[model samples]
Target chain A: MTVIALDVGGTSMKAALVPAPAEPGAGGEDVLASESWPTDRTDPVGGILDFAAHMAARAKALGRPARAAGIAIPGIVDEASGTAVHAANLNWRDVPMLHLAEERLGIPVAVGHDVRTGGLAEAVLGAGRDAGDFVFVAIGTGIAAALILGGGTYPGVSGWSGEVGHIVVRPGGEDCACGNRGCLETYASAASIARRYTALAAVPAGHSTPNGSVNVRAEDVIARAGTDETAARVWSEALDCLADSLAATTLLLDPGLFVLGGGLAQAGPALLEPLEARLAERLLFRPAPPLAVTRLGDRAAVHGAAILASRLL
Target chain B: MTVIALDVGGTSMKAALVPAPAEPGAGGEDVLASESWPTDRTDPVGGILDFAAHMAARAKALGRPARAAGIAIPGIVDEASGTAVHAANLNWRDVPMLHLAEERLGIPVAVGHDVRTGGLAEAVLGAGRDAGDFVFVAIGTGIAAALILGGGTYPGVSGWSGEVGHIVVRPGGEDCACGNRGCLETYASAASIARRYTALAAVPAGHSTPNGSVNVRAEDVIARAGTDETAARVWSEALDCLADSLAATTLLLDPGLFVLGGGLAQAGPALLEPLEARLAERLLFRPAPPLAVTRLGDRAAVHGAAILASRLL
Candidate 1:
C-alpha cells in the first residue's frame, strides 16, 4: 500500500512515496519515494510538514511504511474541513490542513484542491483519461479550473469549485490580484502573460528573446510571439483572455475535454494553437471542447497527491 | 407507482399524473392528474405525442395508470440519448425523445434537460431542498442554468450543462439571440426585461404601468422600476446582467444555492431584492449563493418531470 503524497505549490513542494493502486478504480501510481523542495516562503505549513517528514522517511526506507497522507493544497481549499482555506500564494489561512497533515505525518490525511488535486491527476492519470467530463486548465502562476465531473472532483459548495481565474473576462478590464476586474487572471495568467509582455514592449527586465530567452517568461512571451510585435500584443491578449474564460467554461460546464495544465501549459503549440482557435471563436453555438495537453506534467499534483493518499487507504 | 409528467415548453405544455415517491429519497410527489397547454408550436413532436396520449387518458381516469414517462425537452437535449437534440423554441430536431415517449406512453421513458429538468425539481421538490450545491435559474423567455450537483442534475459533458444564458456578460455588448455579443441572455432575459423596456421607453405598446399594468411585461418592467426612468434603466441593466452572470456563476460553480426560477421569478421582491444586491456586489470574493425563489413555481419543469418519471421506476 504505502501513501504519503504532498504537492503544496506557491513555489514548489512535491514529496511522494506513492505505490497504492494495485487495482481499485486503478488510476495507477508508483513513485515509491520522490522529492522536491523550495516552498518555505514563510513556512508553507512548515514546508508541508517538512515535506511530510521527508516522505515519511522515504516510506520507511522502502518497506512500505506510509499508509495514508495526500495533501495537495494551494489557495482556498477546504476539502471537507481539511482546511487551508486560503493560500494567496501561501500566505495561507485557516490551515487545519487535515489536522496539520495528521499532526505532521501520523498518516490518514487527504486534503486536496490544488487545482483539484491537479484535476484528479488529469482525471485519473492524465489528460482526462478519455473524458468522463473534463476541464482541468491550470495554466500556472495563477489560473485555475478542475471541474472533471463524473470521473470525480466537482468540489463546489464551499470547497469553491474551480474559480476559473476569477471569471470576469475583461468586464472593466485589468486590475485583478483577485480583488477582481478584468480577471481571466487579469488577461490570462502565466503571470498575466509575463506581466502583459512586461507592461507592453521593449522587454528589458532581463530581456534576450530571439529564443535565447532571459526572463520575459510566459515561455518568454510565447517564444517572442513569432518575431515580436510587443510579443504579438501580449500573446494575442493572452489568447483573448483565454478565449473569454473558455467561453465561460463552454457555456458553464459542457466539458468533454479541456485539460491544459500548469506553467502556461509549457506553451506547446504556442499554447494549443491559439487556444484552439480562440476557443473555437468563442463558442458561437457550442461545440468547442477538445484541448488536451497535460499527461501528468508537473507531476499532476503529485499524482493527485497519490490519488488522495490512495483514498485514505 | 403512477408516473407520466412532461413539461415541453417552447410555448407551453405541462401534463402530469405523478405520485411515485412515498419514500425512497423522499422528495414527495402526489399529483394524480394535471394539465396545461399551448405548445403545438408546429407539432412539437406531435404535441409531445398528443400530450403523452392525453396523459395516458388521464392516467386511466385517475385509477392511477401511468407506469413511467418524464420528457422535459426545450433546447439541446440528448439526456443520454433520450435525444430531443435541439429545440430552438420547439422547432425541434433529432427527436427521439425517449423513443417518442416510449411509443406514446406505453411506459418507461425519461428524457430531460429543460434547464436540467428544472434543476431536478429544484434539486428535489423546490428551491433546492437544502442545497446539494445549487443554481437553478430558469428566467423565462430565455435564460438558463441548473447544475444541482451532488443531489443530481449536473448534465454537463453534453446535455450542455446550464448554459447560463450564453455567458459572455457584455463582452461585446447587446445583440445576442445566441449570435452572441453580450449574452446573459442579452441583459437578463424575461424577454430581456421586456425587450429592454420596450427599446428604451416611450412605453406605449399598450403601456400602463404605475402598477396598473397592461403590456410592458417583465412584471411591467418591475412595476415601472419605482417610477420609470426607462424602468430604472432597464431594471438596472437587468440587474447588471444578472450580476455578471452570477459573478460568473460565483467563480465557476461555487454554487450552494441561487434557485430563482422562471417568468422572471415572478419579479418577487423585484427579482430577489436587486438580485440579492447585485449578487452581493458581484461577489468581490465569494459568499453570495443564497438567492431562492422557485418553490416549485411554474411547476419547476412539471416537478422535474415527476422526478424523471420516478427514475424510470
Candidate 2:
C-alpha cells in the first residue's frame, strides 16, 4: 500500500510517499518519492497541506493511489480532534491538520505528537520491538518520552502525555524555556548540554570560541568529554539528570525497557553505561531493564508516521 | 451470582463474598459474609488459604456459591502467575497465592497488586470515576501508587508498574529500609512524617516530648502544624515531597486527575490544597491536574477485589 508520511521537525520536514501496511516485521518501506523542505516559520498547516497534495499527485503519476496521509509535528497535539494544539517550531496553534490535509489531498489523514510517532516506529519496528511495554525517550534539543504499551503509543486524556522534559529533576537549578526551573531539559537536553559546556569552557580559557560565538554543540562537547575535564563534568551532569528522570519513569511506568533516541542518544556508551549504572543503583527491589539505542535514528518519526497511516486500513 | 474477595494488608485482611457483575455505578457490595483478621506475618500464603476457604464455606451456608475469588496483596505481585512476589512487610518471597487459594476453596482465583487494585476501584467507582486516565497515590506507612489507564490498572511489563514511592526524591536525605537513601516513602509517607515530626520536636528544648516517649503521630503533627514551627516544617516538607513525586508522575503519565488515598490522604484539605498548589507551580506548560482525596478510603482495595472477581463472570 502507498501512503504519505511526513515528520515535521523544527527546522525541516521529512516528506515521503512511502509503501506501508506490508507484513508488520518486514524491514524498511520503499519511498516512492521523498523530499525535505526547510520548515516555514509561519503557516505550518498550509505548508503541510501543500506538501501532502504534492506527494499525492506524485504517487498518482507513479500509478500508486495515496490511500492515506499521516503527519507528525512538534509540540502538544490532540490527535482525536486532529488539531495541532501548539507548536513552537511551526509557530501554530490549534491548526486543523487532518482536515487541511484531507481537504487538500482527498485522502484520510492521521496526526500525532512527533516523539510519540517516533516511539511507535521504534516500539514496533526498531529498538523496542521486543518490549511489549517500553519507554522510548528522545533527547534532542528537548527531551520527551513515548510510553509504548502493547506496541502502540499511549495517548493520554488529551494527548499531552510524554512531556518528560518538563519533569523537575533538579528542584532549584536552571531556568527552562518552559517557564520552570530544573526541568530535565534544562540539564540533560542536547541544547542544554551545549549551553552548559559553553559557559564552563568560557571560564577556564576565557571564550574558547575565537569568533565570540557559542560554537559548542552537544556533539562537540561529547566529542571532547573524554579528553577535557570541563566537558566531562558537563557530560556527567547530563547523564545524572537523564538517569534521575529515567529512574522516576521506571518506577512509575516500569516498561522494563528503554530505547534512547534523538541527538544525545548518539553518544552511545558514554550516555548508556552511566545511565544504566545510575538507574541500577536506584531501582531497589525492582530489577534494572536493558537500555538500547534507536535502530531507525531520525527516520523513526517518518516510519512511525507510516505506521499511523496504516491504521486507516 | 456471588464471588469471594480479599484485600490482604500487612496488619489486617478484609474478606467478603460480594455480588457479581452488577450495573457499573452500584455502590457497595452485598457482603453475604465478611470477616477481618490479623494477617499472619508468618505463612502469609497459608493465612490466605484459610481465609478463602472460610469465606467460601460461609457463602455456601448462605445458599450462595462463590464462582471465583480475587485477592489483592501488599508488595510486588505477578498476577499472571498468581505469585505474591517479594513483600517486605510479610517477609514473603514468591508465595504461590492463587493456586493455594483455589486448591483450598475450589474456585477460580485472580490475584493483583494492592495499590493497583485500590486504584482500579477509585478509577471505576470512587473519586477518580471521572478520570479515564488517573494516578491513585496511597501514602500510608509506606507509599505506593496505582496507574489507572482507560479505567483500569496498567500493570507494567512484569506487573511492576506504579512503584512510585522509591523514586529517589531526596537523593541523599535519609536512609530507607528499601536499602536506598531518600526514597519518596522515606520523606513523605505517613510513617516518615510521624518519625520526622517526633525527631524534630525532640530537639534543643529537650524533653520536648513532655510525655517522655516521643509518641507523636502524623495526625498530631498535622493538627499542630499551624501553631508549631517544627510541625509546620514537617508537614510542609511532606507536602513538598509528595508534590515533587506527583509532578514527576504527571510528567510521565499525564493523568487527568490524581486521587490521593492512604492514611495521609485523611489530612484532606491540609494535604490536597498545598499539594495541588505546589504541583501547579512546577508543571509549567502542563496544566496541573486536580488533587482528590480517595472517597472509598481503605475499602477501595476490598471493593476492587470484588471488581476483579466479577471479571471472571
Candidate 3:
C-alpha cells in the first residue's frame, strides 16, 4: 500500500509517496516518488494545505493512488483531536490540518508533532529500534524531544507531551523566546550556540577572533572549534547545557537510548562524544544510554509520517 | 472476593485484608482487617517474606482466604521478572520477592514499586481520579515519584521510570546519597529541607535560631515557618527547588495533574499553593496542572497493592 507523507518543516515542506507500514529495518527506501516546496510562513495554514493538495495531485498523476496521508508539523499538536494547537514558529493555532488535508486530498490524514514523528521513525526503524524505551531529542534552531514508550508515541492527555526545550536549565540566566527565564533552548539549541559565540566574539579579549562579526551561525562556531578558542568555549558550553537537560530527562524517563537528530546532529562525534562523557559524569546509579545521531537524519519525520499514514491502509 | 495488600516500608510493613477490586469512591469500610509490624531492615529479604507469610496466615485464619496478594516495596523492582533488583534503603539485591512470597504464603503475588503503586491508587481512586495523565510525587526522607499515563503506571523498561528524585536540580550543588551531585533529593526532599535548615542554623549570629539546634527535622522547620525567619527562608528555598523540578517534569510529561503524597504532603496547602505559583511562573504557553494532596495518604500503597492483586483474580 502507498501513502503520502508530508514533513512540514519551518522553511520547507517535503512530500514523499511512500509504501505503507514501513518494512522492518527497510529505512523507508520504498518511496515511489518525492518532492519539496517552500513553506509560506506568511499564511502558514493555507500554505500547508495547498502544499498537501499539490502533493496529492502529484501522487495521482504518478498513478500511485495514495490511500492516506500523514502530515508532521512542529509545535504542540493535539493528536487526539487532530488539531495543531500551537506552532510558534509557524504562528499556527488550533488549525485542523487533518480535516483540511482530507477535504483536499480525499484521503485519511494522520497528524503528529514533527519531533514525535521523527522519534517514531527512529523507534521503529532507526538507531532506537532495539530500545524498548528511549528519548528522541532534535536540536535545530530550537531543542525538543519525543518520548517513545511501549512502541508508540506517548501524547500527553492534552497532546502537549515532550516539550523538553522549555525546561529551565538556568533559572535566571537568559530570556527565552518562550517567555520563560533560562530555558534549555536558550543555551543548547543550534541557534543559541551561534548567538552565544557571536556575543563572546564582541568581548575585547585576546581570545576574540580578528574578524569579529555580530552574528554567527552554529556551523561557523563548530567549524572554528579546534582553531578558534572563543568558538571552542561557546561550543563546549552549549554541549554542557545539552548534557544537563539530557541528564535531567534521563533521570525522569530512564530510557534505554537517546536518538539525537536535527541540524546539530550532523556534527557527528563532535557533538556525541563530549555529550556522552558529560552525561555519564552527571548520572548517579543509572547507566547512561548510548547517544547516536539519527540514522534517517532530516527525513526521519517524513519516514514517521509515512508510517502513520500506512496505519490508515 | 478479598485480597491481601502489603506495603513494605523502610521502617515498618503494613498489611490490609481488602475486599477485592475496591470500587471507585469506596470507603474505609471496604478494608476488612489490617495489621502492621516493624520491618527488619538488617535482613530485609527474609524479613519481607516472613512479614508476607504472617499477614497471609492471619488473613487465612480470619476465614478470608485471600485470593491473591500484592506487595509494594521501596526499590528498583523488575515487575516483569518479579525481582527486586535493588533497594538501597532495604539493602535488598536480586531478591525474587514475588516467588518467595508465593512459596511462603501459598498465594500468587503481584509485586511492584511502592511509590508507583501509591500513584496507581491515587490515579484510580484519589486526588488524580479525573486525570488521565499525572505524576504522584512522594517527598519523604527521600524523593521519588510515579508517572501515571493513560490511567496506568508508566513503568520504564526495567521498572525504574519514575526516579525523578535523582534529577539534577542544582547542577553542581550538594552531593546526593545516590552518588550524584545536585540531585533533586539533595535540595527538595523532606530530609533535605531539614538538612538545609539545620546547616543554616549552624552559622554565627543573625542566622542562628534561638533554640540553637544544629539538627532540625523537616517537621520542626515546617512548624516554625510562620514564626521563625530562618525556618521560613529554608522552607521557601526548598519549595523553589521542588518547583524547579516539577516544572521540568511538567514540560517533559505535560501531565494533567500533580498528586503530592508521602510525609511532606501533610503540609497541605502550604506546599501546594506556592508550588502552583512557582510552576505557573516557570511555564511558557502551557497552563499549570492542578496540584492536590493525595487523598489516600499513607494507605495509598496498600490500596494500590490491593488493586494490583485484584487484577490477578
Best by lDDT: 3
Docking class of 3: medium
For model 3, give the RMSD to the true fold: 3.1
Query: For candidate 3, lDDT tens digit of each residue in A1-313?
Result: 6788989964588889887776474546578888888888699878888877777777788876788999999888988668998887898788888888889888899998999999999988888887888999999988889999888988776777788888887777799988987788998888888778767777433344566643567887898999999889989888888898888887787788899999999999989999999999877687787898999899999999999888887
lDDT by residue (tens digit), candidate 3, B1-313: 7888889963589989988776575452278888888888678778777877777777779888888999998889898768898888777789898899888888788998999999999988889987778999999988889999878898876677788888877767788898877788888788888878777866442344567654567878888999988889989878888999898998888888899999999999888888899888888688888899999889999999998888888
Which ten residues in a row are the worst by lDDT in model 3 chain A?
A: A203-212
Q: How many backbone clashes does candidate 2 have?
A: 0
Candidate 2 ranges beyond 4 A from true positions: A22-28, A203-214, B22-28, B203-208, B211-214
Residue B208 error for model 1, in Å?
17
RMSD per model, one decimal: 18.7, 2.6, 3.1
TM-score against native, each model = 0.37, 0.95, 0.94
Global fold similarity of model 3 (TM-score): 0.94
lDDT of 2 by residue, B1-313 (tens): 8888899964699988888862265534456677898887777778888888888889889999899899999888998888988788888888888888878877788998889989988876789876778999998998999988876788888878888888877767799888988788987988888888877776433335654534667887898899989889998888888888988888777788899999888889988888889889878776888889998888888888888888877
Across residues B15-72, which tens digit of lDDT does each residue of candidate 1 receive? 8777785223663556766888888866778878887888888888877788887878
lDDT (tens digit, per residue) of candidate 2 on A131-193: 778899999989999989866798787787888898877877788998888888998999899
Candidate 1 lDDT over A1-313, as tens digits, reads 7787778764768777767862225536557567788888877787778779887887888777988888788878878778888876677779797986787777788888888888888777776876788888888888888887777888888888788888887778878875767878877788778877876765666767555667677886777688878878888988888888887878877888888888888767778988899888878787898887898778888888788778767
Residue A28, candidate 1: alpha-carbon lDDT: 60
